[model samples]
Target chain A: MSSPEVLVHLHQKAVLLLQDDANKIEKLIEVQMENLATRKCPLYEEVLDTQMYGFSREVDFAVRAGLIEESAGKAIISKLERNLAQLYEALDQKSQLL
Target chain B: MSSPEVLVHLHQKAVLLLQDDANKIEKLIEVQMENLATRKCPLYEEVLDTQMYGFSREVDFAVRAGLIEESAGKAIISKLERNLAQLYEALDQKSQLL
Candidate 1:
């Protein structure tokens, strides 16, 4: 296959995976937030570590192929990281209350 | 602040952070992939390690809140993990080529 085709193929796969993953992550954050509010586990979810890293790989490939903007890709993952931090903060607050 | 309001606030903040973070991560992955494809780095991006773990925390919180279904949350993370695995496969393929 040509380089362009390869790029498109990779980009398409990454985007598909990304869309599904993003939705799930968004929902996961929502649930985790509720848990903190109700005073559940004080600890943060530990699964995201692998997911984020995996995502980074896809982003790297996509940018190289020109399928996605570098800044745009970074922002997508950063949002998840930032919100994750926020969740950590809320969890900390909830723990203090206990 | 009331519980619901606090939840809303946390959710909003998390969402904003998440959006930004996601973009960054996606870009990071793209770059890393290029590095690998070019033989610049035989190893995968180490930066992703921290990000994935951090994301896990958010997922944990969202799951607790009922904002995300459990299977859904797992799937989100799993997709990244799978792609990461795919990258690893590519790396392995390249190594074999060498």
Candidate 2:
């Protein structure tokens, strides 16, 4: 069994990781925008899918690892999913504009 | 020029968005792992690149927008980049392991 401190540490680390992943994804979006501007193929889609799925799993793991409550994690993840969807839509629109 | 409050709000929003993006990336990683387990092609790479670039740009924008200081933004973005690199490595290793 994991100690409470260990669990807390893992939870905090997961949160930090999640935050970092989000930053990376946003950067990818910016790149996509630039690619569109430059008439590039927007080949970063595979990477984005990997990172997004990884992030969601980490959140779920954090909840299972006893670092966060399921409700809170779900709420946060839901908000994140919504934001991601919006970002995806934004990217799609930019692609169409190109 | 933006008001201080407006700047702060934007900065906070950027941070929150960054965090959410990070969460999404992690979920993507998990999916990649599962896909590898199931022999999927990991087509999310494009999306990851777009998001990572977008997130970095947002951080830079936040700094320029007076939402965060350059030093703090740089530090945060740097840490995020490092974490992202680690996560990428981990995913690569996992892919190879499959």
Best by lDDT: 1
Question: Which segments of candidate 2 are over 4 A away from where they belong?
Answer: A1-10, A40-42, A95-98, B1-98
lDDT of 2 by residue, A60-93 (tens): 5445434457887687667656665776687678
A89, model 2: CA deviation in Å?
Answer: 2.4
| Best candidate (score: TM-score) | 1
Model 1 segments more than 4 A misplaced: A1-16, A37-44, B1-98
Q: What lDDT is obtained when candidate 1 is compared to the true structure?
A: 0.60
**With candidate 2 superimposed using the best TM-score fit, by how many Å does residue B95's alpha carbon deviate from the native?**
22
Q: What's the alpha carbon RMSD for model 1? A: 16.8
- For candidate 2, the docking band is incorrect
Candidate 1 per-residue C-alpha lDDT over A1-98 given as tens digits, one digit per residue, 9 for 90 to 100: 55455545545655665556666777777788877656465233655545555556555544543445788778888888887788778877878888
Q: Write the per-residue lDDT of candidate 2 for residues B36-56, one digit (tens) a residue.
A: 545445456666665666556
* RMSD in order of candidates: 16.8, 14.5
